[model samples]
Target: MNNLPEDCIAKILSLTTPRDVCRLSAVSRIFSSAADSDDVWNHFLPSEFPAGFAAPEGLPTRKRLFFSLVDNPLLLLHDPPHLVSF
Candidate 1:
């Protein structure tokens, strides 16, 4: 696994559950780095996410963005102040 390219490792990680990924990250330095890659985390993000929506300020990576949305979903407002849930 250490000999695998980072992108390849990330792709393999992408197929696993987020919980699996989190656990894998603790296995080794290489696994931890691959788990943190945007390539892996982006696969966890919803496909229907807003095209132009900006992530909250200071969120660093795709992994952080995924966790943020999971913990605190972003809310949008439509006309008439209707709440739009992501």
Candidate 2:
């Protein structure tokens, strides 16, 4: 548990959902760090998620960008016939 490297823990956490990762963060210091790692969040983000598009001017982390998108999704109206939220 605590002995596991942060990268290893992040790899394992990547297989789980965002909600699950957040819950596991409190289990240990390593878990908390792993949960906040970009590797874990990358798995949670969509495969087609645009690069650098979601990030704000301040250059937020992948996790913050993920939650930001989740809480306030971007509306894509480029195609009038098919409006979508990214």
Candidate 3:
């Protein structure tokens, strides 16, 4: 299982819940990296979640944002799904 491609693992994990992803992260280093990826969390986030949420463009930051939104969903409701400019 550890030998599987990171992105492939992420894709499989994406089909599972956040709890499952976190649990699997403890299985190995590869799992840890893939479990924390943006691709996996994007599946759990609201369908409208903007990819640009990674404004700081860091791996950890993107994971943190995912958890923040999960822990406090109101933020999703508070902002427009996408920002607009004139």
Highest TM-score model number:
1
Residue-level lDDT tens digits of model 3 in 1-86: 98889999999999999899999999999999998888898788777666666443343555676775555554444355643322
lDDT for model 1: 0.81
**Each prediction's TM-score versus the true structure:** 0.78, 0.78, 0.73
RMSD of each: 3.7, 4.0, 4.8
Global lDDT of each model? 0.81, 0.80, 0.75
> How far does residue 74 in candidate 3 sit from its true spot (Å)?
3.1
Q: Report the lDDT of model 3 for residue 74.
A: 42
**Which pairs of residues have clashing backbones in candidate 2?**
none
Candidate 1, superposed: residue stretches over 4 Å from native: 50-53, 75-86
Candidate 3 TM-score over all chains jointly: 0.73
lDDT of 1 by residue, 10-30 (tens): 899999999999999998898
**Candidate 3 local accuracy as lDDT?**
0.75
The pairs that clash in candidate 3 are: none
Write model 2 residue lDDT over 1-86, tens digit each, in one string. 78878899999999999999999999988899999998899887776665445466564789987887788776644333322565
